[model samples]
Each structure stands twice: as C-alpha cells, then as structure tokens.
Target chain A: MNKQLLWLPFAAFIILGLILYSGIGKDPTKLDSRLIGKAIPAFSKSLLLSDQTITEKDIKGPALINVFASWCPACYSEHPYLMELSAKEKVVIYGLNYKDDKQDALKFIDRLGNPYNMIIFDNNGRLGIDLGVYGAPETFVVDKSNTIVYRHVGEVNERVWTNIILPKMLGTEGQ
Target chain B: MKKLLVTFFILLVILPQTAFSVISVYQFDDPAKEARFNQLVNELRCPKCQNNNLADSNSELSIDLKDIIYEKVQAGESDEQILVYLKDRYGDFISYNPPVKPSTWLLWYGPFVFLLIGGFFLYRFQSSHRQDTQDQQNDEQQANSMLEQWAKEAKDQETK
Candidate 1:
C-alpha cells in the first residue's frame, strides 16, 4: 500500500507532463469563433472600390467573407489562393477591408488582382468587432441561410480551402 | 545627504505613477461609469496579445475593445450586458473570469480538489509517522524497564 502510494505523485506528474508536452508548439492564436451556427451580425458598410453601401441582407446564398487589409502580409500570402478559388470554384467571395486606408486598399487590389465580388470597407472595424475579428486574413464560410458555418482565423490557403472550407460547405449543403 | 536620498526615492516611486497614468485618457461624465469601464478593461483579455488584459495591452485590437467597452458604458449598459455582448462575439475567451459550466467545472474546482486530496494524504502520513514514533518509544521504554528488572533480579540473587 505504501509502495502504491509512493507511485501516486509520480503518476500524476507524468500525466501532467504528457498533457503539457502535447500542447507544446501548438498555435495559441487560433481561437474558435462562438459565431459558428449563428446568423451573421448586422452591419451596413460601403464597398471598398465603389460608394455603394452593402448590408447583411446583401449577403445571400452560400458565400465567403474574407477579412483583409493592405497592411496585413498574411492577406498577401493568401491572395493568390483566393484569386484561384474565385476563378475556378463556384464560391462567392466578399472582402471586408478591415481598418485600412481607402487609397492604400485600392492600390493593393489594383496591384494584386481583385478576386472579391463585393468588397466592404470597414474603416472603423465596426463590422469587424461584430464579427469578432482580432487580426486580418480571417475567413468565414456563411451558408445560404446567412448562418456562419466555419471560421478560419489565419491565412487561408489552397489546402485549407480543399480540406476545411470545402468540407464545411458540403456539410452545410447536406443539412 | 539622507534628505536627498529620501527625496530621490520618493521621486523614483511617484514619478512613474504619474507618467503611467497617460494610458487611460478617456473621460467619462459619471465617475461610476468610468470605474466600470476601468474594471471591465482590466477584466477583459486582449484577443491579440493573448497574455495581457485589455487595460495593459496597447495592441490595436485591445484599443478597439476598450473603445467598445467605453461606448457600452456610456450607453448605460450594465456590466453583465456588456460582458455578454463581448462573449457573444469573442466567446468566453475574452473574459478573464470564465463562466462556471460543465466543461469549465474542472478548471474551477480541480485545484481545490487536488488540495483536499493532498491534505488528506498528508494528514494520514503524519499520523502514521507519529504512531510509528510512539511505538518505537514504547519499545524503548519496555527494553529499559526489562533491563532495570534484570539488573534488580541480578542484585537480589547476588545478595541472597
């Protein structure tokens, strides 16, 4: 009994060490959105390129709202994948220009071909706060019913589109 | 020289407090609202910085959250409503004090449970240790009495 008791602390320590070890090197920044399965927040913002205002009602059918900025390097990295997805895939992509200068954002879209169908200018990040966007390059997969199905916090690449986004979109359709 | 040292110590301690007060510059109509804003910011976790609270973090996201909190406070929203708004958007991760739910019950009670178990084991170990010492002392006393009795019997035999 004493020998078993002596091993108890060591067992607990080993279990704790294993748990901590498993968490090592894992990305802590990728937070799960609470907005999943919830309706997209209501917001009225203007298009980035034009003066036309867009609202939550404008976001109909299955679509992708990609939060991007001229200042965000990760957005640039994901831009090519977005362009490819827009051209090939049937996914409708909207851009939310998060807290960026208008001229700089326009220049960025000009330099890198605009893949977004309707880009919303969220100058004060009012929409962003509602979307719970902490950083740039976060993508949300909104279904036909306007309910947000999936949210990816980092740069969305081809692999992410194929694996995570596409699966969720398919799952949403089946439902 | 002693007076100069004391003055220098006072300056060293007090000057930084004034300088650090620059971070909180938003004015409030009501002092109670201002206090609530301060408390909310301190309690809310900065989504960008991760480790720092909104009050301590100077990140852009933290600033935006602070602004939101200020707006809510000015709008006469209760502290609970404001927190719920944030949690609805950012999830429970935004608040430093998470709500007690089934999933978070372990986090809330795990340490206390461990402490109780540890205390029980420690008490048992100490009592057993004390009993061992007492038993050894009793054996020593018995041996000492037996030695005395043997010596007395030897003396009696010698006398006879």
Candidate 2:
C-alpha cells in the first residue's frame, strides 16, 4: 500500500509534465495551420465598404483572409503587400478588421488605399481569438473548396509570395 | 461631549498622516514621466500571468514593481537605468519583448525544440505500441485456436 501511494505521486508528476510539455512552445498561429486543409470558419461580420454596409456573404467565393488592425504598426508595413494581392483577381482578398475603432480604420484605409474586396469588422477580437490569432497582419489562403490552405503570421512579404504562393499556383508545396 | 471631541481629533490627525504617507509614495503626476511610465508598464511582462502585461496586471507583485519604478524615477533615475535594473532583477522575463541573444537562445527556441522532440517521440511511441499490441493480439488468437483444437481431439477420442 505504501508503494502504491509512492507510485501515485509519481504518476501525478508525469501527468503534470505531459500537460506542460504539450502546451509549451505552441504558437497560437499553429491553430491556423490546423484549420488549413479544412473548411474555412464561418464568416459573418459587418464592415464599411465604399460608404456602404458589407457582410462576408456578399463576397461569396474562395478568398484570401487577412486580419489587420489600425493600431498595429505591422499592419501598415504590410499595406503594400495587401495592395499587390488585392490587384490580383486570381484570388479574392478579404480583410478582417480586428479590434479597431471604426473611424480610425476608415482613416487608415483612406491613407493606405483600400485593398480589400470587403472588410469584416471583429470589434472585440472575439473572432480573432477563435481563429487563435496572436497579433495582426496574418494572411490565410483559401482554395476553391473553401478550405484554408495556407496561413502566414506577421508580415507577408516578397519572400512569402515567392516561397509560399507561387508554388501553390504551380500545384506544389515548398515542403 | 469631551470624549467625542477627543476621538474626532485623534481620528483626523492619524487618518491624514496615513493618507499623506500613502500618496507621497505614489505621486502619479508629472505628465511626461507618467506617459513614459505607462508605456514601459505596458511593455513589461507580469511574469506570473501568460497574457497580462504589467500595466494591465492586477497582481500584487506587478503593483509593487510599478511602485518601485515610480520611486526610482522620482529619485531621478533614467528610464534606461530603470529598465536595466528591472531586467537584472527579473531576467528577460520582465520585458514583453525579450532580447534575442546567445544566452536567450533557449528562451526563444526552447518551445519549437520541445515541440519537435515531443512530436518525434509521440510518433515513435505510438507506432511501437501499435506494433506490440498487434503482436500480443495475434499470439492470443493463436493460443485460443490451439486450445480449441486440443479440446476437439479429446472429444473425438472419447466418442471413438
């Protein structure tokens, strides 16, 4: 019985170690990767588009979802990439405006030049949290099946286009 | 009436002294210093909580750290000195943006390494366990069939 009691504590310690090990070092963005190759999460939000109300359903198609916030400096840095992406009709690029004041986001768009087919406002970051986003300027590529195929955290730069997207276009992954 | 007057006098005198002492410790004035302090607090980590920064943290340690910063700044310490002192005391965990260095390679890369090692072990362990279980089940099935065959031969001999 004493030996059993000793083993009890050892078992508990192993469980604790396993729990910590499993949780440690996981990037919140990796959740996006898990969502990749799976159907995109439901998108239902209202955002300002060309002085009119726009909803996610209004833009019904496979889209590249980019989450951005006006207050995030990183979003400003990635504006050029968004512009280049939006210019392309190969994939519809939609924006999830994450946790920003409406007026400030509008001002940011005006200065940066709007580069979204439609913008969906996630005012309180509820949707962002659900998507396991740590911070702003994350990009996701959805295939024709509406499955999220790619997720890029932080800034999406020239290297991302060269390394990530071009290969997808050519029907291959960089591995 | 005399007792009441004496009590009132004692209360007023003691309370004001205590309040004055408390306020003197946390003088939240000087707009410039206040703004810089706020910015630093927001950038500092609570250490106790995963998601909370010092500015937003309500932990007692965080509050004490803030007060320490306030005291040092009021004593005319430079912002850099305060940052250095805090970093020295708490290690890089004090800062939200921990500096990347050779010493900090573990802090930065530890998680990815852990994940990779864990995944490798999990894959190996599961596959080995699966193979072992398959072998055990096959052995059990074979034993059961052999026992049944022996029982059938004994019954046939009894019938003859």
Model 1, range A53-143, lDDT digits (tens) per residue?
9899998758899999999999999999999999989679999999999999999999999999899999999899899999999999999
Off by over 4 Å in 2: A1-32, A50-61, A88-91, A169-175, B1-160
What global local distance difference test value does model 2 have?
Answer: 0.72
Model 1 spans with C-alpha error above 4 angstroms: A21-26
Q: Cα miss at B55, model 2 (Å)?
A: 13
What Cα-based lDDT does every candidate model obtain?
0.91, 0.72
Q: Model 2, DockQ value? A: 0.02
- Estimate, for each residue in A32-150, the C-alpha lDDT of model 2 and write its tens digit: 34465656655566775645555434654456788998888999999987787768635578888887899999999999998887788887665554454555778877666556677
Give the clash total for candidate 2.
0
Fnat of the models, one by one? Answer: 0.80, 0.00
What is the lDDT, from 0 to 100, of the residue A118 in candidate 2? 78
Residue-level lDDT tens digits of model 1 in B1-160: 9999999999999998997677778899899999999999999999887689999998888888899889889999999999989998889899999999998989999999999998999898899999999999999999999999999999999999
